[model samples]
Target: MSEAAVDISTSSANEIAPGIPDPYSLPLDKIDVSQGELFRQDAHWKYFERLRKEDPVHFCAESENGPYWSVTKYRDIMHVDTHHQIFSSEGSITIRDQLEDFVLPMFIAMDPPKHDEQRKVVSPIVAPDNLAKMEGLIRERAGKILDGLPHNEEFNWVDRVSIELTTQMLATLFDFPFEDRRKLTRWSDVATADLNSGLVESEEARQAELLECAEYFIGLWNERVNSEPGSDLISMLAHGESTRNMDKMEYLGNLILLIVGGNDTTRNSISGGVLALNQNPGEYKKLLENPELIPNMVSEIIRWQTPLAHMRRTALEDTELGGKQIKKGDKVIMWYVSGNRDGEVIDRPDEFIIDRPRARQHMSFGYGIHRCVGNRLAEMQLRIIWEEILKRFKKVEVVGEPRRILSSFVKGYETLPVKVHPL
Candidate 1:
């Protein structure tokens, strides 16, 4: 399906509801941060703050996605993330359960030996050697995109820059058809979007679009499976010992994983970094003064954005966390967005400091077995783009309010109006 054919919008989700009470005003048990509307309004911070302070391991007896435990503190989230044995990633990784009829079995949702084996198959794509080879190509693409931006004109930075750059990169990684690159963005959006986000009409529609994605990739797999091993992701999966025999559903699951992982997280971070800089002028000035801080600022951007807000893990065995007893099969959500702002772990947690010490120490990439495999690649893209932006533009000024995506899982932007000033 073409990107334009998919009508995903945040208009309905972005409407501010009447009498929105403060986080503290609500009773403890009544607080549910899983609502997508809160994220759409950028009002989830206070709710998470309240949970981190009073109930680090609070259990929501009810939510749109059903009962789940929220791990808000930095250390507590780290514990759950690292101890995959106690907290399994088996069934699903989001707060919403996967449709039993349309389950997609990707490596990120697998346990033990299976996950490790499947993950190892594609790890080489981002290895030190491969990334070094990819650096020049990425820089070239970033420069062209930046150079092409209209100067002294208000534009949607999310579409022109963030989506364009990341979608191009995803096309490169998958060796997908460059002309149809926007489909990657659409698929990623559809894969993680809340049903009520207006991204799709219903679960059936969502599944249908994803199946179209599956069919397209399956064709690529067929063509590559017979050819000599190539460097692209599809080639790797087609030729790899472990992934070569994956079922159609498993293949589609991994494709969605790679597409979303390669697109949304980095794309949102690109938009978020610009928004963050505009929000914190001092940091932008700090960056402009010493362009050397671009690399460091990239980590800070990821931390500040916390793009993929939370990762859900199902408890394999009953366990206690932060004094809360987590029963077996309970859905446990590690609120990475909240953890990135925990005062106990991050200094001046709410502030955006570019030269912050130990900047890479954040929960955005997750931890342990499932820590983001393409983290370095994501950082590299951010660094190169910022470096290029600095070389040409004095500032990418935010001219209007940024529209947030209505998704508690994928915290991102739908649109961010900006006007570029040449250096």
Candidate 2:
């Protein structure tokens, strides 16, 4: 951690001030749902509930990331997500504008022709054929991980299980050096860590770590660029016509995008599913009675967890959304976290029902063009892990409260203490 970084576990910029009123009690204009502390404390639900009901397309005139519009309803968020012409993804996808001097131009942050071409370059990796090929390996690795856990002894499941499995999968995707696989996890954290989150001390430190990530990947790029075209991600980028000519920053940007995409969603969901099942004991009982529900439960887990809370877009033109006028260039945030729990679309929105009908209809994987490229892979990983867990464990008990990551952008866990009881 950087010396300049504050330990957000103890103090955070977004912490509700002493004596501040509850989410509904506060003035509508005073509600800023972008606060990291609200998510960290797991106290953000009621805030979004208020916004979804009273002001679905509310604007906060002031926030740490500056003024922005919050689109909380499922339909409105789907509108912003699908209509790329109106809500552009060109600038930054998070509320915080990318630092002018340190901008990294990955495909997710690019528009049209360029974005389409670059996305096509790597999309093949997650295609149906490739996912089928990877399934056996994923299941084999997942079983080995579960077999290694100490029975009836408390341990941080996020570190021991979640991080380990995802890091291994990331290494295989990139064909990276297996011994240094954890570096991918580190870079993912540095790329999205809030300055006050204590993950990195300052903006300078964050950039420094990301640059080091760039240097390491650059070495791999050099190795793969000259070789015959290969199936690994590094080789795909090195040889793809659309991406072959990318400059250093653009390369780094795409690398960070893939790393975070591959790691965060599955890793966090693996941890989140356990915590969710433990909290909703009846759901766990249902799953134990019938393991066939794992696939549907995987989708429900992603919806309930909403690993990535919100994705920000820049309004490209003046538009009317939920009766609010959004001006050109204004930052618009689609709160997927809130939209996933929208009552208008999802029945019993707050409950975690593993066998819920149309479980796949949630917005955890954003809609339209920028939807998660690795959506299938994320689901497969979660399903495989849970299936293996059921085969070996009677239950995986959450013994302590989870410590959540202090960033609204990456809704995830830092640690979750648990104990496994063998079947």
Candidate 3:
């Protein structure tokens, strides 16, 4: 470790820019800080305020995950995501289980022309027109799930609602067996959150688990390969215009990326939305009264909830960010949690405002060429779920404090207990 300590004393360190958050002082990634702390302290804003202020790209000496540069400001994170040449997500650049092989990661983890080519394959499928094609089905799926809720009973929102609906939707998209859908959720979580040797399981056991997940997807893929055409994401990926006879391992690798992409991230967003609305009852009422706002409200919820709190990016070449020196291969994590609540870019940066004019401007879905490919799909699921939720329940209130997961890679409630009563 360098004996040189960083000085975050500059005024700019306290704030990113006028009207936005103080990136310097926000405690965005101190996962040691509890979810209650996250909810109560606006620690994210403070951590980002400091990052944006004193060391926009300096290392976090105290992070147990090790010294990662917290890129708190919105523009800084954007720069890293878009400038794939300078920074890379191509391989182990992602902190999750070191990229065991370079064969095939997803467009999300790739760079340049290659990433763009793969992204184009399903871009049309998730486009507004294609999503509109699946809208009624998506809405109906949400309705069936919500309509079955015990009107007068209390339930954990993540388990009963978010997990069930998201896993089911992904099951529908991939044609995976619905009865075993929870397995998909688990595998996806393990793929991302197993972190770098954080799990107690033996390395062989973990690799076996990942292979087990890829096996199930293989079954699904084989079935799709032999079957007739259908209008779903699997079919799109399987029979894409640019795809050829890609190797099984490579195919499985990309499948893992898609599953991880399509599963846990959005699931957390769904769960986070519920927790946000329940905690801020006024915002909950805002949606209940004006259902039209569901579209805009989705943006607000994503901004406030800030699910998928941070993502790691490896610097490919030696570079200087916000005056801090970053050597080649150093791991840096962008704290979207802090960037989303940036005070300089937002009005009342600490409070949840469903009507925040720039709520859509948040970085939760990421930015640039490698921005989330499933963004539209995620929005579709969220909007449909909320619409049906509003129609059936007059009020959905939280019964207690929601608990966050232990892992920092994906930050969301483990359980969102709620009281769901009929309208």
- In model 2, how large is the Cα lDDT of residue 6? 29
User: What lDDT would each prediction earn against the true structure?
Assistant: 0.91, 0.92, 0.69
lDDT of 3 at 379: 80
164 Cα displacement, candidate 1 (Å): 0.7
lDDT per residue, candidate 1, 263-348, as tens digits? Answer: 99999999999989988888889999999989899999999999999999999998899888889999999999999999998998
* Candidate 1 Cα outliers beyond 4 Å, as residue runs: 1-19
Q: Model 1: how far is 347 from its true place, Å? A: 0.6
lDDT of 1 at 174: 94
Error of 2 at 282 (Å): 0.7
- Candidate 3 or 2, higher lDDT: 2
lDDT of 2 at 193: 93
- Model 3: worst 10 consecutive residues (lDDT sum): 1-10
Q: By the TM-score metric, which is better: model 1 or model 3?
A: 1
Give the alpha carbon lDDT tens digit for every residue of 1-423 in model 3. 110112234425454332323433445443232122332223344444555665666565554445567777777887777777888877643444353443445666677777777778767767788778888888888888887778767788888888888888788777778799898887776665543434426656656777887787777767776777566666767777554355666666677777777777777888877777766778777777788888888888787767677777888899887767889978877778778766777777667667778578888888777678888888878888888988788888777766666555566666877888887
lDDT of 2 by residue, 1-423 (tens): 110122345443453332223576788999999989877877788789999999999999999999999999999999999999999999788888998999999999988989999999999999999999999999999999999999999999999999999999999999999999999999999999988998899999999999999999999999999999999999999999999999999999999999999999899999999988988899999999999999999999999999999999999999999999999989999999999999999999898899999999999999899999999999999999999999999999999778889888999999999999999
